[model samples]
Target: MASTICYCLWFSYVTILHLVSSLAKSDNYIIHMDLSAMPKPFTNYHSWYLSTLSSALDNTDLDTNNLNSASSRLIYTYTNVMNGFSASLSLAELEALKSSAGYISSMPDLPIKLDTTHSPQFLGLNHRTGAWPAAKFGQDVIIGVVDTGLWPESKSFKDDGMTEIPSRWKGQCVNSIGFNSSLCNKKLIGARFFNKGYRAENPNITIVNSARDDTDGHGTHTSSTAAGSRVDGVSFFGYAPGSATGVAPRARVAMYKAVWYDHAVASDVIAAIDSAISDGVDVLSLSLGYDNVPLYEDPVALATFAAMEKGIFVSTSAGNDGPDKPLHNGTPWVTTVAAGTLDRELRGTLKLGNGVSITGLSVYLGNFSSSHFPITFMGLCNNDTELTTKAKGKIVVCENFIYSSILIQEAEAVGAVFISNDSDSSFGHMFPSIIIDSMNGDIVKAYIKKNSDSTASMSFKTTALGTKPAPSVDSYSSRGPSKTCPFVLKPDITAPGTLILAAWPEKLQVDVDNYGNVTLFNSFNIVSGTSMACPHIAGVGALLKGARPDWSPAAIRSAIMTTSDIFDNTGRFIKDVGEGYKRATPLALGAGHVNPNRALFPGLVYDAGVQDYVNLLCALNFTQKNITAITRFSSFNCSSPSLDLNYPSFIAYFHANDSSSRRVQEFQRTVTNVGVGQTTYVARVTPIKGFRVSVIPNKLVFKEKNEKLSYKLRIEDARMTRENEVAFGYLTWRDMKHVVRSPIVATTLKLES
Candidate 1:
């Protein structure tokens, strides 16, 4: 799982100089400058950037009153991810810096956003039998979370009944405000904060009072979802009141607070990755998504690549920007996770006077009756001033998700119901409110239309288990065609992310009352996004790591992907909730919903090494100079075809001259026998309707463990009947007990006029 080479054409010295000179008139720009070569590992490469900038901009002196101030003007320099520095500087300053001999090309520093977990029983990992106890519950693995911050005092981070921290752990819990060495035990092993990039972006902002304490509950939720301690009687006001345990409850966590309320800067994220890698984390879980850029250029991706090179597995969120734009977290080297539904849903039902009951999702702690009052529209209240007088003491209906709190508290409404266009019904307002989807909202609206007095009583029920037809891809979960790398399938796997009840910080506020009281709930919360999904897989990766200490990052990923299930609990193919209830494709669900039990014992895995990506760079036509810059190894050469990288998943793209030409594509794949020795597996294909697929040497025999064998898959497409067509299928190698599945996709571009 080394850096998956993102190749681009090389820019000549004159072209770079010309581009830099043209930027002299700009006021401010955020640029990522690539270095001519990677700096020495574990060294302060910031000094290299400082020296280069100082020499290039000899006419101007830096204002170095403090490191933060200096970073604000000069910007923070990154080393571990790539030997480059990101800076906020003037056009003239950038031009002067471009004169340095070490400069490569500079690109815009894209802004990123938070992409923002679940029942282990649903995935069946609670038993002592099977691979559950064999994994030792991932007690030896360390999961590093790069998110908002951590709340060390939470019960989830407690270290009761745990062994000492692993001696391989090299990280430390910095004694920041609130976060101290005492708070970091065997469970919560490390804690650190990064904000120089945030401060550089926001000049006047300061995070003074609380350091490393999760003012926002995102970090605590994700971290705990991955490897929180097993705590009994954990609940959010009696909702999900059971023994709360993470996917890997015994695994230790190292918290890296990289995101701020204002921004999750690329520079800060890269720095956190650098520290986490140096700190020797076993698995890195990042819930943030950078802007849509080439995979090689993304700072986080590059840093994660370096981490992967060190045998650390990395899992990232697929992003919540979905339904239409799902091509996020497209890097093939890291495990990109998509959010899926769970078997349990917290449902709230409204019993109407007309003998109709409607159910939706909500975490409402208490139930109340509003049958005596007539339900009326809140006059489309967008703010408190917009609340109508007639709406007082009534079950007011609001159109938007944001205005319910105002209508409930300030307007004195007896209850509030949000008529939402979105399908997700999970509500967390500090009021007796339930959001009804459009279909049910229409039913409620029609009852009001037929009767003058529309009366309804609301009651919140206990968690509903065995939710039929569950594990659907969340509507908001990003879909994927891999815009950056179309040949690669994105969102490497799916996990339970929707309405996941996990640990939450009591200090964070999701809502407030009109009386100036901040509403805070302790212990647990239900949050949805790929952010939650990522940690689930990270925890699973830790479990796999604990089970197989010698497995590479690629092997871990291959195990998860190959052993996953594409069908839901109902035995039908999983469906994407956002795709109009249509059957899910590999583009949406990746290899499919993760099967933790099966992943622990994947029989065969497609193993890839650092040089595999170097060959891909060669196929992409990257210059030898750029290759040396990224690999840091002089005299490096790419010797293999890009499509022959021995990846677990395969994609074949066919080019046609008018949809009439016969097109054939070839893909080579190799798998290592990780299961039993002296076993033979046969290749099988679930061919697409319009494609003819054949696998040469369909049967593979392995005499020893860790033995590698290769096979070639050839696909021939029939006459393309449509423009810009895509066909989905899968190729599997089956031995008797294990199904090594790989998703196969073929696409044809639209003919140009």
Candidate 2:
């Protein structure tokens, strides 16, 4: 009987495996078409696409006349972003499409991943002063956020002081299950979702029909951080209590739901960008990215180029894989942001039996007895049965911080002490818990080993403001010297991304207390990532747009970069928490932490337009076909290709052995005066080691506000070392009242003999 049961089970497993293999044979792919090469007979691109798809399908019965049957295989038909469509097709079908007319290229649909909250005062944004009043609090500036869905009931979305929706906005509030058009007021002008790709991939799984309702809380948090209205008396479980306001409080918000529960498909993201561009958003904020790929193949990069052509400013997060990793969304057109620390800390104290009190960070609010509990050391606290047996009624110490309080709670432990190497301090633990650095952790572990009755107790959480050496580059923020495009400096700027307080979905529970009760303030939560930092720049971009409606996207980016602050509040050079708290390099902090007030009147700005990007693509050695795929244009010239793309920062690559001969490279840049009338600007270069830098015509005299001036920067390598190394400096163009600074980086590569 047991043998017969085994045979039946084996048969069932084999049948299921065969079924899965059959389903996997057909995969999703994004097909790019050359619009210029479209057959003259086919007037409508949609009908042409249908005919083209039907020709490729194995089933001849699938024709354009049978619209339902033909459309069933299509995922998304992109128009504004790219001339393409995403569909599920077999290898045979893909080959047929390649052989058909107007096909540019095709790539298998890849998965994307999500990569904010902060004090407005930390960024020098105040209601009545500085850039806030000058820009009228970003009045009527529409910020389109493409991420997870949103929570309509959050107080941050209330249209208390908002004006009517902008007449230029052509977006609509899409109604779905749990969400309707009525939820979108003047503050939230539009909400839409693109999930056909996701649904096509996971055919059996059920997803919420509502695109406006956020369940994971990521979208709500990011959207609110960029343009949320002010909500007074906000806190996260009574921690960091204050009025929470987005960087641009009065700017309108429009959400495009592309990221779902786990991951986002590239096709869906492209569709979202297409919709945002067609809907007329002034600024686009995307807090998600995938691995680094070439510009020609990156869907986000391609779509953003189109948005830039339409005069829309794009802000994207540098990926979360940081400390030392290649950054994603490295396109020159978008304002890529890196994560930094805020001046706030959630403080918690851990008291030992020997009277040694160590203060760390936590967001724990559960009550703990004053009496110290017996302490025990667990390597990682990963084994559940062992923990339940040995850690009952005691304080458990862990070597790693990832073990949640639920594990300790399930083990019946009174509290937990996590020792971590990371500087993160935003975790909310249900049980009384605290996270300390590895050095402090050693002290606790040693104390437990020495005494027979070692015990420890944790205090409640407290908020600490004005922490020193803030605005430091976070250890988790991605770094630069982009491998894909080494000529351009990535992560254009850094902003407050750690311990940011913002609106959250009220229904989502953060954590539960000792008695299994939810202890979180449902309306708000603190999150950290490059994701949070991206929206800060997006909000700043909106403020710039509101203040100077005539400024292009590149002008806004240049202003933000040139007028950034390299020094922290303590008047010390900003540091990097990643490299043992060393002075941050341009690769880590970009131009430096963003300063909205200084960015408002940057005196002079470096501006680049669609033609400039086309030239850049040509300089990158991309073929005409590849350029057409990315730019959606049929004709482009590579005759005057130059690596110097007139960017905000300068980066020069050299060989280490070239020291014998002084290798000199020159870069040309043009700046337009945006400040007061008749300004004389002088150039000054911070001397870099092993290099001599000079600027021709060091003095630039602008006769009028709109006058444009050009200059050439020449760098000569003097004493290049044998090892691969990097040197950093700055080129500052200063008038009497304004300083326009750009970072200069020189990298030396070792050559083989």
Candidate 3:
């Protein structure tokens, strides 16, 4: 009874503390001012946005200088995509602005919570690591990366021994704070920034706008991964120590700073895309996006479609909201990339007082004594609890429900152990701690509860190299069956995104430990995300562009997707690390892990031009007016329905009730011969369990290069499963030397029809 009462009191104290903390934060002085209503219909987005902001500021009684600096005071404005402006203003000031004009709803810009090397060989791009590819190293191609910004001073951006800049490049460097024209060398040909939206979104914070200068390491890391110059001895504290080079090391980078402090405003990103397209970049690399929205409503998708029409390839991240999360901005025109793991892992171990040692994972670089110490739970270490002294030098076990780092810090424990719901192989903690799985965590908790002198020892290990069964889909890499466009498969391919070692901005790569110890590295660090994967494919796209100068964006995308390998190094089918180590499906890994060498020589490509995409837009249920607005075409006639987009992969969507259990779906596709002439490829369909799939005119014979052949794919499903059931298969076009593959997925999603 005493224990129960004590537990109740402790829980009550925590609940009250949390409530008080929330109230304290809610009562803070600075307030989030939001302009909710979208302005009246306007043709020009920028003009209307600037005018609305000016009018809002005009209502204020500030001096001329303050009024003129309204852009600086603004946080973020929603112009083209949605509507609204978020800023840091007092309640009265916000109300004044809202009452002024063109304001509806008011809210805060709530803080949204925000891989490389051996990957080259893993993707069969071993030749790119050296000079074997010769002039094919993306020589004249320019890759425009839209992200945080660039770090010009990194050795990877040096223009040493670089050739003359491409004549087609019409870009220039913008001078902002620390950024200068000198940073734009032959290698990094252009640098620009869009921050009006950022400033409008973050008026309370005085952030430096250094043009394309990257304060956070995200932009620098991605840009370097896409086209960094070859640098020897690049690594993060001796880990991954070796020569570091991008897939297209010689590709020129045009930096566009659209993301600010990890959050990108839709208007700012669209502006950046427009500028990049106008600047004549051969390829655009975007490592940022948000939740999935309709393609027509997505500014990024609309801009990218425009870019595709202009012959520039756009590669975007598949997003990090993982396991089975829907992909973001996963339009058919853009190359959506997913994250995959490499052959490297960093492991650590925990020794319990029961003389049992369990392996946990971590990348913590600090060293501690090997002796075991008494352990306790955070509940016992509460402020008024009797375990404060017991937790002083002991390792404390904390539930992963809250931030383990904060709990450990507050517990005053020498070391900490966090109970996680993730897999045992999961390991990303950076402190002197071990994140054990819940099962083992419970065991540790029980051991500690059974005896008052429970203790454990923790130790770190050197980076494990060639850690086998590699090239698996990263669990966090966003999955797809595109929420907006379910007929198309997203994440065109996966790339080495986990534990990737790449360039890091020196200024932002510093870490301070619990002992007031500061650790700094000069060049590179390990990071993981589909953001990392996007650049690998973008760099590959640059290489393909440099080689096949006449290849359309669709042709390049087709080449990469159709040629990607679905197997890992161990000759086993690649696993989706996100889906509990199950065999990866087409939805998890798209076409598979990107294979650069195979892509370079892909015999046949399912090609779709601008008109083809426009035809796809016509298939959607939008009115002709809406379609014209989306495609920027005045007279677009409706084409066939969704599945006939001539995509490299095939997907069939269905939603069947008990009355509509049996259904048939058909798709038409056209493939162009980019390979040797006089090649005959035969189609072979791998049957799905519950569906009958057939391809008409299975033999495709190409008499000459660039010849086109059309075929029909039909899927008949007879089984009635639960609603929204998804099944997968594949179709392979095989020749003597080439095997062009495409995934076939059937989904019982009625809306997809």
| TM-score, cand. 3 vs. native | 0.77
Across residues 1-753, which tens digit of lDDT does each residue of candidate 3 receive?
999999999999999877544432311121222334345575333334445555655665533333333443443332211344434453334445556555556556443210226666556565544222833678878999998898888888888887999787889988888887877799988989987786887788777777654567888889999888888866565445667788888899998898877778878888999999899999999998768577777877878988999999889999988965688967889999998887765556676776545444466666779898888876423342443555667887777624446445554677777776343232333467776655556667777888877888888744545455777887788888787777677768888888777777877753234344455555676778889999999998998888888899999999989998888877889888777778898888999898877787789998888777777777767677766766888876565545478899988876566645448889888889888989999999997978899999999988998899999999987676567777888899988989999988888755543
lDDT of 2 by residue, 503-526 (tens): 898987653343575545479888
Question: Which portions of model 1 show Cα errors greater than 4 Å?
Answer: 1-118, 209-211, 365-367, 376-393, 396-423, 436-450, 511-518, 623-629, 655-662, 749-753
The alpha-carbon RMSD values of the candidates against the true structure, listed in the order shown, are: 28.3, 28.5, 24.3
TM-score for candidate 1: 0.78
lDDT score for residue 92 of model 2: 54
lDDT of each: 0.74, 0.83, 0.74
- In the range 1-753, model 1's lDDT, one tens digit per residue, is 133332222335567777655543333333345554535651334445655655545533332221122223444343222346655554656677677666776766554211112368778786575445877888879999999888888888888888988887889988887766787888999998888888888889867434464567889889999998777766656555577788888899999898887368888888999999999899999998875676566776668768888999999998887777755767667899999988776667665665455556677665576455677665356756656556677777677766456555577777777876444655444567777766556667767778887877777744556555778888888877666555667778999998777777776664333243545556677778899999999999999998898999999999999999898877889888888778888878889899999998889998888888777756656566655544556676555558466777867767654564558878888889998888999989996977888999899989988898988999988766455666888998998778899988777743212
Best by lDDT: 2
TM-score of 2: 0.79
| Model 2 spans > 4 angstroms off | 1-118, 354-356, 376-392, 397-413, 419-421, 438-452, 511-521, 658-662, 749-753
Ranking, lDDT, top scorer first? 2, 1, 3
Q: In candidate 2, residue 293 scores what lDDT?
A: 76
Q: How far does residue 124 in candidate 2 sit from its true spot (Å)?
A: 0.6
